[model samples]
Target: MLSYGKADVRNASHLALSNPLSKCAESTSSDLATSKLHTIIDALAFRARSIPDQTAFVHLVDGEVIEQAITYRELWSRSQSIAAYLKAFEPNGKRAVLLLDTGIEYVSWLFGLFHAGMTIIPAFPPIGSRGLSRLALICADAQPDIIVADARFSNARERLNDLLPSAMPQPYWVETTIPTGGPDCTGVGPARDDIALLQYTSGSTSTPKGVILTHANLVSNCENASLWMGDIRGRVGCTWLPPYHDMGLMGGILQPVYDGFSTLLINPGHFIQKPFRWLSAVSRYKVTVTIAPNFALDLCTDGISDAERSTLDLRHVRAIYCGAEPVRSRTIERFTDRFAAAGLDPATIGPCYGLAEATVLVAGKPVDKPFVSFHVDREMLSRGTIQVVDENAPGACPLVSSGRPAAGVEILIVDPLELQIVPEGRIGEIWVKGDNVGTGYWRNAVASSETFGGTLPEVDGQFLRTGDLGALLEGELIVTGRLKDLIIVSGRNLYPQDIELTVEETDSRIRPNGCVAVALDDGERERIAIVAEIKRSEKLDDVAQELLRRSLTAAIVAAYGVKPEHIHLATPGTIPRTTSGKVRRRAVRDALLAGNFAQYGGRTRAPVPADRSAS
Candidate 1:
């Protein structure tokens, strides 16, 4: 049995006691309290010893008033037991796929896998044949040694077996829900450099790639987040992001543990069905910190009713981090304005930027200040220059700041082709170098080298190419758009996100957040094509279609001084989206090229005036 004395437990509970103030307080010590610790296992062990009885996690089920809580002591004991059981299968140093539903149960298994020294591959539990097919592809690529799941999902073995190729080896199955007892082996875990997680990207633009994150990467990221956000040691955090995503896993689940904060977690489904439940939980639990993507903020702004807003008291919330997608300034403004009556502070809104390659957080706004944006000349922005102008200036576009880089992180805006640093206020690819950055992609050396091997002429080592276009103003970072999704028309650069947003804003008949803009090479100049989903309503005749198309075209021309070559209006859910709700622009483009939306009354490309130009 591993030794665990009373003194160790006492010391462990005090791990995060370095900061006694709330998140808003000015904390000079911007270092992770557990920076000296090598791996997350060490931190968890310390917590078990120090604050054994402190609630570690709370799960609020849909329609259930009573929330389930798990204390540190109980969590450690169960995880150790499960780890001991897993050791029988000799899973050490092997990748183990976790296909379980979200809850305290999944949390326990996650720690158990860590304790057993297994590389974890977190995947969503497959729901249907399509989901199973995706899982099968992941299984083929990962080639995991074992599959750990709830008893209810063990039957997935048969379905996966049928879908997988005959040559691949079948993985061992282990059900974590059942009670198991075995020899104690609590102290055994991975080293600092050992792989901790295989976080799969959402693949919005291409095939999914598994990002290899080490224990040190995770610990460093959590430390950087804590330091960047001030002292949130004892703050209550709430989240409904899926456990499989990087932001959800690192920022939501693991960060709280590293800081000794109690977290209230609701299922993503519940939050989608009723966004108010997320707010309600925060009010009831007095949650001080929370995080979500841009769409979730838009959803709550539009979905929550006046009566629902009246019940919410969000004054206790010190930070509401918005990330995982392009942060829209209008969404933040609308949400803050709409919720101010419920005591929501505009300062609490944090528009941050991050990706899986860097663990989770690269930069975030300080908790003490309100979110800010810069209004720049849109034409100059298209030409890679960020010229600050008055909001009412002609052709001005508001670009939200993604804050400064976290401690121990270095960011550079470099030309994508030449790999040379861009001038200040000039948009370019964002490259990051930090200890928190992951080693590389799993088993994919080409992508690993291409993305993680970026180097500058004056830099000593490789930097992570974020593939995101942004510019540095003064000291803050302003993300513009994705490099691959940049649309150049008549010598002017335009972001598809900007065009899609304009389309969504054009007509009430168009569904919110379901539009995609792509550029097609029409022999000479690039032509802009858009595929948008219309809200399901009374059938629209030819007249309605013509009016809708004209309104959309007029909106595009008004917002972006260029006419689109084609616009297609399809039924709801016709446009494809990644699992994390990011619009798959490339996939939509492919479908458009393949005539995949013919059943949804697809429209053909209309010739644009050759003399048209982006103002």
Candidate 2:
């Protein structure tokens, strides 16, 4: 059980601060900072010749059973053949949308598109007929010259045509899958500034925007992450994150190829269905590094049984990079404690911060290092400043550090209202400048300029406005909340995450990661509204719900000193999340205002109808 406690892991610098296997910072053989290679594909070509037989990727059929182990030469050759096939359509510098499932085909075709010098658009195929609108939106915006798919999705044209923008021409369709040991063909050599691919944001906040990453940007991010995380080669990494996302693409897929190493791949479905398979893979393949969202840590810690846990060894996992959501301090401590019997290192849980705009990693540390944290005066933290305090201090809230900036990356904490750099330990919007930062959104010049062209009056340089609220304490980045999601009551800035965490700890039936706290308009007054999901395993009766609602309201008041105007308890899976598994708090607020929760849950007393005056 996840217990909300006052204590947590602090600055445990006693843990190994360095990876002995690695060389000094930025000097590793695969370090692109000091290499002549401009693009990742260039590095791949070199490795393909020097170490042709090296294992590049291993695919898990069911997250544990190995389905295929693709070699460097095999992948290189496959990319070449696919590139040759693409050339028949004059694919040079044209957009090709890859709508494929998670497998070797996805990886092969991804590299193939780059080799063909075609601007790649990485997107997931629709599930049945669902999600076509979003795909159509992306496709319409991209105006792809060709659509590449696996053989199974050959009928995409019929379905996509109806959804595509009327003015755009129908994209040419190519349905082909590569076979092993295909005859090779020559591929194009791309320059550093050549457009490599476009990765669309998961759209947790608004419409999905494609972040344009060039050949240089992709290569730089790989090396920058490697510099911060220590050596990349001679170590096994694994990932079950959707391969198309920035984290999985750069960290899981491209990093190994850049360093001439092998990484295990698991279908996201497999990991979700059987969380134990992750630990099993770590034990079986001796995986040293892996990446996942914050929820996966709690899922694995609770989902794995003592009997099942005993059959595995996790000593090999050096770092489990946890990000893509608010990194809970309790989760890191709970996971480390639960697997202590199985040789899980306390330092293995590394909480990092990133976004699609920055090409995934903005700040991370050596995986071998422990995640640092600070217990601050909760009220001061909300008022755009930090006051470090003892854990036992009254009204103390613990915030986990998401490490420091990567090599060649500069982070500036700027006051959004003042338009100046805030003093350290003061909360502000996180602004970033680095090679890894994408150029701009695809074809959206206005949005691009606002996001990527920010500059301070005193400091001159291009900075990407991260739209995230965070502070720097002793040089470590402590992300507090989203700027747009900051909720204020009585002039106090209350982060929704803080309020939501308090609600989860209020009752045993409240699902972990199933609660969202938002501010709703109540006439001229703004009110705090909490929508939480009850676990399906628990019985939900009117009598039980009434008791639970009281507890939830009381808990919110006790924690935040503000009364929740309404508490609605819903069935499991009532809340919405993005494709990347981030809770859509904005969507939750929208649903609440739209009266969507009325159909899903039993609320406390007669619920207050949302005041549509603010809506």
Candidate 3:
């Protein structure tokens, strides 16, 4: 069995309400009051009115700072002008596509559309030429009457127009000041059921579906989330999540604005190229709330230099929500330890769970409690049993619970086929139905009917079927794996993460963090292939490869009674990841299929020599 360090003498009990600092509420009064229309608009206008002179947005582009802050009265007046301008351009509540990155213009553009009662299609600005082509097709499908773009997107707009000049309508660029001669508009919008924004999903190629979020849906989610976060309105937050994403759009912008909170919004490119800037902004602004995925923590810890650490102080960060991907226990521990020297609170790193379908949040632990991890057997876990094991067991990886469902939401584990509820601690497909559940996708009836509609069973008068596989243990939701991510091999199921984790812990020679487990097909038999990243300059060549193969074989044989087809060693950081930090395993598998490892700077060497193989 593999060895492990002893557990520290820290407390892991359930957070008590008696602890004034604890934010977890076992029994919250489920009074999710609807946010009055007048109150919400008044609140937004109030911020501008109160701080009309203060800065609303500060842009640091190409090493230059451009500031724009409008008072409430000025913002309202400008919005009226823009609304009039837009109505003159396209009368009625026609659609307006926004092709701009996150900036002051983005806000004005949205406010103008809202003011005009027109649908807003938020397109990612940095999508460039290729993304623009895809976006044009999406627009064709959306068939928007008009488009609003900034100067930066002129090239993309021209390219899209060139590609489909006849089909695609002409777009109006918002370059000069807000317009003045259009229909006069004011007051609360259409009914709460009217669509406010059409958020497009990621899979735009095979099936492009935009979620239709109503005013009530958006308002309810923000109000509920505000209740969850203790509605600390007026607090300052720093965000770098892309505006196109649900998390960035709803959580980063809508939630803050609805609750009257001030936030420092940064673009995604800034975060990807230099993650330190994200942290620097938080430290500089003394931000109290921030959210990011798991890989962001890994990048921050791996990329930050020692010299940069001296200027960092994270003491003011009260709560950090981590979701969008699997929450790695080891990664968080290392990150917390690294920042602890700068007075960062380990308890503030709140591991959360949610998805786009559920409006971005399902459950999360209290901010005051440090993360909790359950050590379970990897083999038994794949069999739908969460077999608790000793923390130091050789094949044990701690599974983090995403806490209980939020107030006004109910989540349950059920059999995907049978539709019957599963017992506690037994893995099953997760099914949820609540006010937080979103309306069906835009125009894709087949997909919407199959996934979000009532094809699945109902729970307490609400439709269900989450597509996630998890179990409930001790009254908390423990997501084990994805129902669709299981790989069928030789009449058995193998989880890629289980094998990848095994490889990382089996041998010390392999790059600890850069390893992936993928299945390889030889046109006859399918076998598992372990692609591990080796530290450069670790010369052994074939010897290192053989050692990895043998070590992985022993570990698998002892744990799952299986052997891999091959063990390939690669350079560190070769695996591609999504914008939100999820490892793009299919990309690596495709590279292996096309035999492009060598071209990709990977070592094309054979396995280790027989004699050099590990015992």
Candidate 4:
């Protein structure tokens, strides 16, 4: 049974008399253990009754300092009050877009929507014209009934007025700070099958799609994550991930609340400005679990100085979940080697894999075990085979395992075209099925049927086509790359990430995670094209730029046996990326074909072999 402090029990009894709808008597520790808590609202109510004063979330600034905190009772109260305000707009079972910046207000509004039985459509506020246009696209797609924003963003009202069409149904705008006090509001908890969130894809590979996630899906995924990560009740978590993304919303924000733990939250901008604060917060708060993408691990390793590293103590951290993008083995090695002195355990590094369609965690390694990788022949991997080899062997490529499927989740490697399960070690499309898997895309029947209704011959259950290519070796999932992103050259399959990583490693001027490899059809055959982002330094002469181009082309040929016909080097931040940080290779390819970067004139054809080494 769950444990509660004596003082909290007393406070719950008093609070229950004031608000009878909370049903505090029915949410005892025994009931919490037996009932699944269908919706997040129920979970929050349970916690409020059991641990009224327990810290739910804490926002931190620089130097690992807390700027604000919210207790379980306070969170419940504020969310209920906000829910009452939203109900006046008749938002019951309707979609509400969130435009507020990340903070306590954002958290409160999210829960408030849940309490009011409204579907949530979380989005980032626009920064400029480009951002406003993107927001326009999302609003057009979602067609929300209401929009919730913080009044602090002075430009939000103007931006919304400009982007939203006059003829379209304008959503009712509600400011979070403005209190609309009325009679005591009663919470009508959402049913298990009700739509809880309409999470939009990050649009890295294609246009964004609204994924329909039900309350059951969210609850199931959180329960599975808790089981996989061990008992997290009352544990601490830290994150600097954006609240709009799945990794942040589900893992960083919701999971802690569902598991009855306090989270140390930091703004993503703050962490990017100073990566050391992430680790320092873990040390200061004894954060047991945190999640980040692969690039964040690299940032912590490269951005932190030895002087700062010496002051950290991360022994209390049990798991550092790495996902959202491709996990690099070298990044993990570098981080562990650099921070071993700071009490970081090698086993604490957990490589995880999931998507917005799965409500976050689909698979993750156990926190007690060290990360695992397989060294396979590079040529074999390119040919769609996983042949294990020695690390020092010629053309050896290291493939990191994304761990086994989470509890109650099943993963199948199936041929994309045939929809049949493939051999265990053969690379194929990843198919997943579990209670955590979302039902379908919002209002998109064709895509929903094609993606969420995938069937396996002679199998009884439906599976989600993950669009990712991977193989299961010894029961561990090794994600290779996206099925659509594979570059086919001379009958060999080369992953774009492999080529991009090689290009970045070949030159110090090339920005890490800023290169994209794409295949262009030359009417008869598909030719390779690479768009690499370089750090803007001194202007290079035409001759020097040509020499740099040839060097990169020759390196690609030597590494993958495929020479890129066109190589375009652009300034930093030119390559488009999703909010979660996955490179938008398709968008970059389109921009390159359209000659978008011709003004900077970084494009160059490969020089002859004789002039390749001339610098």
Candidate number achieving the greatest lDDT relative to the actual structure: 1
Worst 10 residues of 3 by lDDT: 15-24
Clashes of 1: 6
Per-residue accuracy of model 1 over 356-396 as CA lDDT, tens digit each: 99998998897788777999987888788999999999988
- Kindly provide the TM-score of model 3 when superposed on the true structure, using C-alpha atoms: 0.81
Worst 10 residues of 1 by lDDT: 18-27
> TM-score of predicted model 2?
0.92
Worst 10 contiguous positions by lDDT, candidate 4: 19-28
**Which 10-residue window in model 2 sums to the lowest lDDT?**
1-10
Give one digit per residue, the lDDT tens place, for model 2 in 1-615. 111112222121311232112221122444444547988788778768866876677677556553556777878877787777666677778999988877776788888888888898888677666567778889988999998886677666788889987899999887764444333455465678998988998887888899999998888888787777776545777899887777878888887777776777889989999999888777766678888788898888878999988877788777888888889898888888989999988888888888888888899755677889889998787687999999999999889999988888899999988879999999999999999899999999999999999898768688999999999889899999899888888888999999988888778688888888888866576788888888878887778878887888787777778888777777777788767777777888777776666433454224346763221
What's the TM-score of every candidate structure?
0.91, 0.92, 0.81, 0.91
- Which residue pairs come into collision in candidate 3? 48-72, 49-72, 52-71, 542-608, 545-608, 546-607, 546-608
Candidate 2: count of backbone clashes, pairs at least 3 residues apart or interchain: 0
Arrange candidates, best lDDT first.
1, 4, 2, 3
Q: How much lDDT does each candidate structure score?
A: 0.80, 0.79, 0.64, 0.80
lDDT string, candidate 4, 360-476, tens digits: 888989868888899999998987878899999989878899999999999999999877898888999999999999999988999999999889768879999999999999889
Error of 3 at 572 (Å): 7.2
Better candidate by TM-score, 2 or 3: 2
Model 2, position 265: C-alpha lDDT score: 85
